[model samples]
Target: MALLHKAHITPTKLELLAAWLPARPWYAGDGPLTRVAAARFDDPAGEVGVETLLVRAGEGPVLHVPVTYRGAPLDGAEEHLIGVTEHSVLGKRWVYDGTADPVYVSTLVEVIRTAGNEAVEEFEVDGGRVSREVDLKLTGSGAEVAPATEITGHRDGDPTVISTATVTLNVNRVPLIVVDPADKGVLSACWTGQETPAVLVHLR
Candidate 1:
C-alpha cells in the first residue's frame, strides 16, 4: 500500500518536470505540460518515494516518467538528480531519475516477473483514511525473469529501452492509443479516458 499525506510541496512536480523535460533529447514538446495520471509503488523500507507520472505537453504524445524521492542524496548518481524540493511533511526530498535508483529498478523487475497488481493508495487526512483511485492499471507477464546486476536506460527513441545483462525492457515512452494484446512478455496499462490499453513496457 502507498500512503499519501495531505501536505503541501514546494516547486510542484509539474513545475519541476516542465524545466527538466525540455532538456531531454527525447522530448518533443514545445508547450506547457499537463499531468494525465499518476501511480505509486510501495517501498518496503518506507524510506523512498516511488511514483510514475503520465504527462503530455500540449498536443504531443503522453510520456511516462518514473521518479524516486529520497531523504538524502543517492551515492554515485549525481547526474540523475531532478533537483531537490521541500516536502511539507517529509522535509527536503532529493529526487532522482527512477531508472538509476536501485529500489525502482528492483521493484519494476519484480512487478514484471510476478505480474503483480497495483498497490492501493490512501490519503491520511484528519485521522481518516481516504482511498485514492489509481487512474492507470498495470499488469506484468508473470514469466521467469533473470536477475540484473547492472541496468541502464536509453531514451533516444520512441520506445525507450532499459537493458541489463540478461533482459532488455522496451518501455513505450510515448504511449500508443490502442494496445496490442498479441504483444507478449510485456507490461501494459489503460487510463480512465482511454478506450484501449497502452503498452507500457515489453520484455525483449
Candidate 2:
C-alpha cells in the first residue's frame, strides 16, 4: 500500500515539472499543464518516494512521468537528477528520473512481471484515514524474471520503449483514447474518464 501524509513540498510538483518538462526531448507542449491523475508505488524499505504523474498541456497528449525521491543522492545517477525539493516531513530530497533508480526500475518491472496492479493508497488527514481510489488502474504480466543489465529509453517509437538486456518495455508516454490489448507481456492502465484502457508498458 502507498501511504500519503499531508505534508508540504517546496516548489510543488507542478512548478518543478514546468521547469523540467520543457527541456525533455520528448516533450511536445508549450502551454499550461493540467494534472490528470497520479499513483504511487510502495518502497518496502520505506526510504524512497515513488510516484507516477499523468499530466497534459492544454489539449495535448497526456504524458506519463514517473519520479523517485530519495533522501540521499544516488551514486552514478547524476545525469538523471530531476532537481531537488524540500519536503515538510522528510528534509532535503534528491529527486531522480525513475528509470535510473534501481528500486523504481525493479518495482516497475516486478509489477509487469507478476501481473500486479497499482498499490492501494490511503491519505492521512487530521488524524483520520481516508481511502484514496486510484484514478488509473495498472496490470503487469507474470513473466519469468531476469536481472536487468541496463535500462535505456527510446523515443523514436510511437509508444516509447525502455529497453533492458532481457526485455523491452514499451511505455505509452503519449496516451491514446483507444483501448487495445497487446499479444505480449504488457503493463496497461485505465483512467476514470477514458473509455478504454491504455497500454502503458509492454514487455517482450
Candidate 3:
C-alpha cells in the first residue's frame, strides 16, 4: 500500500483536500485554500491514522474536518485522491480522500465503540494539526457507528506521530445536541427531566 512519509509534510494530502472539500455542501467556496494545517489524534496502530485540519480557502472562513486515511487506494479511488505527486516526503504515496468511502467510516465507528469513554481530550501538534477524541458506550443506543480504519497522523517538525483517539458514545439522560442556530433544527437540553436515560449515537 502506498503510504505517506511520517516525518515530512507533503502536498499529496493537500491536493486530495483540494478536490474533496469543495465537493461537500458545507464547503464555502471562495477561492483556493491559501493555508492548510494538520494535527494528529491518537492511534494504536502505527500505520495510517486520523487528523483534524483547518483548510483556509481564500478570504472565506476556514473549514474544519476530521479525516481518516487507509492503505493506498481501493480500486476506483484513483479518480478521487490517490498516488504520489511532486510534493511528498516519503516519495511514496498514501490514500488521501477516504471520508466518502464506507470502509473508512465503518472503521472509525468501530474504534469509537471499543475506545474508553470517560472524557474528551483535545491536543494540537506543532505542525498545526488539532485533534479531539472521547470515549462512550453505545450498547442500547439505536445508532450505528464505524470503526477507525487508519489511525490519525501528525507532524511535529521532524517527527510525525498519531496522537491519541477520541471516542464519542451515547448514554440516555436528557440529551444535548448542538446545531447551527441559523438552521431550523430543533433544540434539546441535557437537563430536560430527571429520569434514567439511555444514550444512543444517531449516525445518519
Candidate 4:
C-alpha cells in the first residue's frame, strides 16, 4: 500500500498535490499554482508506504511534508482540497487527503522531534504551541481513514504517561509535535490506518 503505485506515473503526483497542499495549515498564498516533486519517507506499518512531498506554489513558497494514505475516495475529503484526480494505479482513484491521515501524523511527530531546540511539553488542538503531543489515533486503512487517537487522561490525572512529542525544530517559529500515547516522553506516533478514532491510554 505504498503511496504511489507502479503504474501511477509521475504526472499523477502533481495532480494529487494540487488537491492536498492548500488544505494544510502551512500552505500559504491564494490558491497558488503548485509544482510537485518526487518524495518518499519512513513507514511504520510496513503496509501503507510514506511519501515526502516538495511542493512549490505560485512562486510564493515551498512546502515539504510526508503523506500516507489508503483506500478509495476518503469520505468528506472533497471540500478540503483542490481536487482528487483519478489514477490508473489501483484501478480506482483514491482520496488525496493528508490532514487526517495517520502517516502524516506520524511524520509530524518526527519533524517536531527533529526541529525543536529542547524537549518541551505543550498541548494544542487545531495547530498551535511550540511543542506538544496528542494521544489521538486514526483508523481506516487505504482511503477509509479517520482519527483513532483520543484523550486518555482524566482531569487532574497523573501525568505518568507523557502524551506529547518533543519539538525538534521550530517550524515557522511554532514548534510542531504530537500527543499520541505511543510517545514515551520522547516522540512517537503509530500509523496503522486500520481503525477509527477512539480513546486510548497514552503508552508513554
In candidate 2, residue 196 scores what lDDT?
70
TM-score of 3: 0.43
* Candidates sorted on lDDT, descending: 1, 2, 3, 4
- What is the TM-score of each predicted model, taking all chains together? 0.90, 0.86, 0.43, 0.41
Error of 3 at 95 (Å): 3.1
lDDT of 3 by residue, 78-148 (tens): 54453344423334445554343334334435534454222234444565544343222112222233444
The sequence of per-residue lDDT tens digits that candidate 4 reaches over residues 1-204 is 122333553346666666655555556555556544323444545544344444566665445433444545545545433344444655544444343344544444443334311122343435644433322222111111222333222121112122223211112211123344343323222222313222212222
TM-score result, candidate 4: 0.41
Which candidate has the top score in lDDT?
A: 1
- Give the best candidate by TM-score: 1
Worst 10 residues of 2 by lDDT: 149-158
Task: Flag clash pairs in model 2.
Answer: 115-140
Candidate 1 deviant stretches above 4 angstroms: 147-157
Using TM-score as the measure, name the better of candidate 1 and candidate 3: 1
Q: Which is superior by lDDT, 3 or 4? A: 3
